[model samples]
Target: MKKIVSLLLTATMVLGLAACGNTDEETPETPETPGEEETLTGTGEGYGGEVTVTVTMDGDTITNVVAEGPDETDGVGTPALEQLPEKFVEANSADVDVIAGATVTSRGLIYAMKNALDPDANPWPMVEEEEDPSNVEASDVALGFGISSLGRKGPGADDTETQVWSINEVLASALFDGEGKIIYLNVDQVEVATPNYDGEGMPHLSGWPGQGGYNIDEDHDEKVDGVTEDTEENFIAEVELWKTKRERGDDYKMGISTWSEQMDAYEETFVGMTVEEIEEWFEKYTSDRNGRPLKEGSEDAEDKAKYDALSAEDKEMLADVTTSATMSLNDSHGNIIEAIRKAYENRMGLEITEAEAAGFGVSFMPRIGPGKDDQDVQVYSLNQVFANTLFDEEGRVVAIHVDQLEVASPNYDGAGMPHFSGFPGQGGYNYDEDHDEKVDGKTEDTEENFFSEIESWMTKRERGDDYKMGISTWAEQMDGYEEVFIGKTVEEIEEWFDKYTSDRNGRALKDGSEDAEDKAKYDALSDEEKAMLADVTASATMSLNDAHGDIIKAIRASFENREVINLSVN
Candidate 1:
């Protein structure tokens, strides 16, 4: 009877449809019999571990699902299994979604099916839900990195005081992500103020009489009635010079005759700056010490102005260039280490000997040499590189041994000049002291012209003293005289030289004041006069300049592309 009733209703519905739709062109596709979505199955890679899930469905609804895990814990993964089945059922008409913190497992289950048996079933709805994987809780495993010692000190508190220097540097490196960094730190501990002096380093401070002002108040009759204070009369005079040398590195080498000149420059230029401004400039950049922009609200405006000042291609090039605060933190660390080392040496009663102090000077200390895991006791310093060597009381070098040797400036050949082996355009040259090598008709290459062999490679139009003689001589010798001479005439060359000399002379006339006076002199030169100082070395006729710098730069840039070949020495 139920079949008969269904037949009658089907017939009536067919008749009604036929009567109504004589010419109906847009009709929904016929629906097939209800079927379950086929469960998907595949291996899924996850940060935590790999997982596999299987699902079961009925018609358009998911009746059941099971998730299996190899590494997943029961308590942690059970939540995923429990919540996912319900989530899957709730999204029966739509694609499956992954739960936060259980994304891998949720996804593993949802994607387990190859295709939906139900045509309306959506494939992946987790994307729309946007679940976060970071929410998953997990135990953190310790990761280790290489560590090297930064400094040295005695055992116990003094040792800690010394080692703190290196530890601080490591912390700083970790914070900065390493743009420019010091290789390592040197540290030492100075024991001061024994019970005899009641913790006030009085005797130690009083060692240098006029070096440190000693005030003895005999009338008061205190336990230790003497106090030494740093003053103009006895203070470490020119602490400023020491500071400048440490910071500038090799810029402060001075002659005794030029003492007045240096003092005058320091007084004039430094006097204009307030202590606050000086400190600010000297202070290194740190994350905690970040400062607001000079024009904070108008940063976009400022950027636009800068952008407008440059070409489109330059703007694109600059897009990759990160403009951020460059910290002098490394210098600060060096300063701290040097100060501590000096103080410690003073305490040890190890007089840094005269012979040891011969050239520039050297410090004495127990140091570990390079290529040693265990400390190799030795003395080291920046003497030979930056200055001369110094010896200690026992006829041994009092140099500070360092893990890294950045200032290890080994001298070049017989000439006492520092070696620049790794520098571009510096290598590949031989010299004869007593020769006036002619470049074309001019005696341009002399022993003083070191980079003669590499002049033809440079591309920059405006060359420097490094190129002036060497390139011209090379061009003449190489039968490339016409090539070199095509650019500028003899008059033009003379004019360029005159222009350079005139500029320098003008600066000299103003007493080389790094102030408004020097600027006034530079501004006084006419445009035509300035134009005369061109790189006329390279004209259509000949190259007065060598392109060695350009060649070396290109080689350096393409270094990454070069294939490395390993040859077995052993």
Candidate 2:
């Protein structure tokens, strides 16, 4: 009986040992096999609002990460969100460096990633609250104004050998928050040269592009009349001699210099400065020939030393360049500053002194006509006009006006008659004879008579004058086209541009249907008018397209910068 009991105990012990080993093997096998990728999403407070991050892991290894913050500012917090995903994936961990300017957003992104990796983990420390000075309120407003000019010096009586032209565009944007503090200020300038010439031509001027008879070598050494290179001391001596000659009223020309290279220096000084401060600087510096802050014994030791190192002749040359630059600034920035001030006043409903309502201006001079060919050089001039309405908080246009100014040289034919080229001047239409009228009282041409003739012709044509122009009068077509843009947003206007401006297959907005008045007017036009209609419509369409492009560009700039902008309906 004792032997049988002992055998039963041994069997039980063996069975228990087998069961333990099996359980241990199965437990580890279940977790060892690779499982499906796990994805988790978490959100945390960011600079603007909740920032979300999604993390995907394959077993214990991080596979992918994505973060998004829609409410963040474009150039600030947005950059942090864009950069954090790569860091999370590479480290296979949530710890990462915070972006410099976007600390809150960066920390939020990291916290969200951590949460995604371990949902049950303790939450990250809350971001410390800090006052934001740039926070915008509903009542906050900003005003921006852009102006451009194209100036041309026509062949004058004394200096008729060459023509000179310059184009400059300036944009002044000022942001005033709800607290009436100018939080942001940006001023940009773009200067474009004319097509062919490079500064040197008639009147023998002494400035950039015109060498003033002085030849400068690559090392900036100056020589005159094939003479040997002048030493720095000798150059200074010659300048001193010239000063004596000038004191005695003898005319002498100095080497030319340009202020274009110094524009950035001038721009840097204007930034972060108030309008009054900028005006004061302008008044002070522009009055003298320096065109900038005085460099002699400047607060910046480097600048003072550099100025001291320059030769006397070089110093004088720099002064001349600065003087020219300051003069240009007076001519250009004065208008821009005044425009911006008026724009601000208009936004606040203050009394404005300008005749027209506040609006930005853009001017471009595009060379039209034929390319270089020996014969038949085509002459063309294009003046583009863009008008945008400025709206109040209620979406009501507070200011609406159109401005037309003649800045560049007018397009003239060989006979000195003003020629309207492009789509408006199809068939070489003569403006003078085409509008002349022989009245009972007077025979000479007059503005009233000219317009009267055009109106009479249009009226007669509309009344079934058998002049089949295949189009309505220019006045009717333009009025109809302009009506299409009323009350439309900038984006909406661009969307509808092609539909209204197309002249293909009589698709122009003014090209009438079977029973439309425009169709009847077009069908009743004379053969000569009919022949001119296609070309005229084509030209007008081109003009409308170009103007629309410019207007859209201006409006987009305003919107992108988060400013209140509108287009003029009238």
Candidate 3:
């Protein structure tokens, strides 16, 4: 199969409210330092014209705030000018609620007041009260990954929009509150073939990264990684660098806000909601066909019906949701709500704090190199893996999960899957090692046989003792690595990999290569490094990157993808 893996959500850290903090520094151009009482006047742009404010400060207290804008709209800007001054005087700060129908006027008045108070600040920013997570994992918390498809849209007949098939991967991650509610949620999606999807709307990806032809690279020839053909290798090479919606941040623009910002808005709305509640909310608020919130004044019959059906209170609620997010939550764009449901199903409890963080990632690879070298008897295997993590406020990995599923041709199953030649399913034949033949029970390869084994797609953990690693099962060793990673940060894990794993293959240092250089590197390890290396061998001996999978990459991304959550341990 091709590399049609689902997308992943990552975050760019957000700025806090330090901009709203009180400052003792005198205004940059204040004429003189006022001792007990001082009056300062400032002006700002309103909906119709300039709005002005004069602040009267008595010592540290705001004694009065007066705002005026003569050309402003009578009913809209007038009420804001008359009412917001008193609000500012009572609050003593420009950060407050925006007047419902007089947003521009209220904002202008607030900006003028802020200017009168400091003379050196931008008009008050439209800031929301966001609780960014400093921590994410608590004992009761769980991190999950949910993926869905947008199906596929045509390289359509429409000329107005670009003609291309879009193969989509919508992904969601959530921090579960352990009380059946989601504490934090992150969502993102990727459309693989924006301009060049196959006729069937399946993926026709090459090593090209963008709509503009392929990028030249040192490793890749011709175009992407230098390959001359559109093969699995070419696809893998291309997708490794692809960015999801959240990962693209500001570059992936939507309407007024970036994709990440809008997704953040949707994510915040999901907090404290159960999976069922979220589904109901999506169905009730969003359009039945497109999954977009109804516009208040839309003349379309369906939209008007939805708009009219909403109670006055629900209308306000819908307005609050649409202000920051208007992207379709499901339908052709992406089935985000379905992903959330999957996340709840996949949830695994961990001990973490709401102030901490959690993240999810997957690494995929297709291996078909020469191991048991035979021209016709070559092996092909595909590995897709996951290693999500939980972190404390200071970024220590508190919980780590490592699991994988390896599917391969019957001739070549790695340590994770044992290969028995000549079989439709279970094998009872013994192999003649010297003669290179099978003896006893006979089996043949056929379409029926191949189709029959479809149910044989088993996970490493599901394989249990069948997945032999000589010293232990694959699951046991992976578990041991998880133990090694506990309490370690991403940095520490990287350092550990550098010290103990072989640089060439990413396997445990000496197992894959014990050459002179490898021996020298191993011998030069400090005592602590050597001890840690020796200890880890008891559990695992697999590469985190080489032919196996990108476990390290997944872990690092999990850290980079951390976001604030509302989990509670107690």
Error of 3 at 477 (Å): 4.6
Against the reference, the lDDT scores of all candidates come to 0.28, 0.41, 0.63
Best-performing candidate as measured by lDDT: 3
Better of 2 and 3 by lDDT: 3
Model 1 per-residue lDDT tens digits across residues 1-570 = 644875798899789888886665875665755564566443443223555556566544566655556754454444566776566566652256554334444555555432233223433332344333221111211111111112211111221121111111111000000111111111211111111123212212221112233333333233434444534332222111122222222222222111122222322222223334323423311112222112112245644454465566654433322122121222322222223222222221112212211112111111112211112211111111011112232323232211111111111112122121111112212221222221112112232222221121121111222222333532232223222222333343244333433343221112244666445654676766444323232321122122111111111211211211111111
Error of 2 at 383 (Å): 3.1
Q: How well is each residue in 1-570 modelled by candidate 2, as lDDT tens digits?
A: 544775798799789777877653543322344657998898876766789988888766678888999977677688789898998899888888776546557867888887777666736444455533332232334443333332223212112222322233343444443444443444444332221223221111111111112221222222122322323333223222211111212121111112322343454455445566666655543323333433344566655666676678756654544432332453522244543443334233212111112233333323233221122333333333333344344332243322222111112222222222111101122222332321112122333332232222111112232322335533344434434444554466566554333333323334454646446656665666555545545534423434212333444333333333221221
Per TM-score, what order, best first?
A: 3, 2, 1
Task: Give model 1 RMSD, 1 decimal.
Answer: 28.5
Model 2, total clashes:
13
Instruction: Score candidate 3 by TM-score against the native.
Output: 0.60
At residue 526, what lDDT does model 3 achieve? 82
TM-score of each: 0.21, 0.33, 0.60
Q: In candidate 3, what are the lDDT values of residues 255-355, reduced to their tens digit? A: 43456767778887888889999999888888886788876887678988988988999999888877667778886666788879977886777654334
